[model samples]
Target: MSRIGKKPVALPSGVEAKIDGQTVEVKGPKGVRSFTATDDVTLAVEDGALSVTPRGKSKRARQQWGMTRTMVANLVTGVTDGFKKELEINGVGYRAAMEGKNIKLSLGLSHDVVFQVPDGVTVTAPKNTQLIVEGIDEQQVGQVAANIRAWRKPEPYKGKGIKYVDEYIFRKEGKKK
Candidate 1:
């Protein structure tokens, strides 16, 4: 009894969804993306709508079926709306630059650190202190942003380092003498 998988996904105008065997290809005005449904999850396009049907009510079948549907829906929406993540450098002299398909960061260390960017992901740094990660895949976009933030996490005491714009660092007050 999966509530979400039971609902059909309406195909927006200018968006085309088709099934090629086990893979579902969705093409929209923004871009194109595809996904292969897992076992027990059937994908079909009917009357300009995409639907996912579970083979049975077993735990594995229900879980995979619903997960596949959610992932497929995300893939379709990501290609159309795209995804973005923003990070800020808090420490003084900490900055970043785009260098040869990699992001070069100087986080108060003696040497610069360079992180290679995977294919299909775009890293934009309008300002050295600001980082913008954009991609069609939501998972990739978020993972890249998290990895970048992990390089020099913000310290609770000083709150200096790389962190998301909305992230909050819980600070513990110093003990009184």
Candidate 2:
């Protein structure tokens, strides 16, 4: 009954997928990633594609069907195209720079904030106000970007802070005495 679950994930050339019990492991040129689904769903790789099916008519099985299928698809995509997140810094004297394996941020604070880059994820500052985070794992890439943005979230008044490149800040009118 899940539309997404009904579709099989196609395996491209140079990409391989293997199924072992409830776990699905995908390997591609970029890297390898695996996902373990719950017993409510079954996994299989056939016809150069991976598929997921519910084990029963129960609600839990139905719920897991779609999620499990998406997880497997993510594993395939991660090992192939990978993921990226961009951040923009907006504020006077606020900027970012790459310091070896970490990022140094100046958010108009008393002292600069040093964020350590985790393994499997790369953070690069193309410009003083721009940061690019990339990794084969979607979750890690997104989390790293979020953590960087957390250092100085955008404020509504002046819209001065760090935010996603595509993010929009709702500005409020200043006080009119």
Candidate 3:
């Protein structure tokens, strides 16, 4: 038996959940989100909570059982509190600014890098060296942050680049004179 799949995902206050076949939809104060599970798993809503179970004892069924449960839980959390990712720019002459719906980044490059914000997600630049990404879907928010960080990843030597607020950069020793 799957330990994670055994526990039901409780519906918090002001949050509603519904299950139609293998699809689970959740609505909350923030927004609404839905997820479709594989055929190896079964979905149901009961006792003010959502639950997932494997249709068979096979390996794939067991895998789907846990994954489906977690997906449903994520849907509930996304609809309720949503997700957020923060990035910090650390480099000389490196900064970020918002232009309409796009973000302009200056990572010590000759030309400024323009990143267009995607739909269902919001990007904000509170400071020239800080960025905040928010969205109802956790995956989208994370992916957007990753894409932004890819433009200027932190260097081990000087630790000068873009990175997550809570991330740590491993430094390397300089060559001997």
Per-model clash counts, in order, read: 0, 0, 0
Could you tell me how far off, in angstroms, the CA of residue 74 lies in candidate 2 after the best superposition?
A: 0.9
TM-score of each prediction: 0.90, 0.98, 0.97
Give a tens-digit lDDT track for model 2, residues 117-159: 9999999999999999999899999999999999999999999
Q: Which 10-residue span in candidate 3 carries the lowest summed lDDT?
A: 16-25
What's the CA error at residue 165 for candidate 1, in Å?
A: 1.7
lDDT of 1: 0.87
Off by over 4 Å in 2: none
Model 1: lDDT of residue 139? 91
Q: Model 2 clash tally?
A: 0
The residue-by-residue lDDT of candidate 1 on 1-177, one tens digit each, is 888888888787888887887798888866788888877888888887788998877889999877888887887787678889999998879999989789999999889999999988999999999999998889999999999999999998888899998888897777689
Evaluate model 2: give its TM-score: 0.98
Candidate 3 lDDT over residue span 1-177, tens digit each: 999999999999999987787778899998889998999988878888888889989999999888888888899889888999999999889999999999999998889999999999999999999999999999999999999999999999999999999999999998999
Query: Over all chains combined, what TM-score does candidate 3 have?
Result: 0.97
lDDT of 3 at 130: 100
**1 or 3, which is superior by lDDT?**
3
Ranked by TM-score, top first: 2, 3, 1
Residue 163: error of model 1 in Å?
1.3
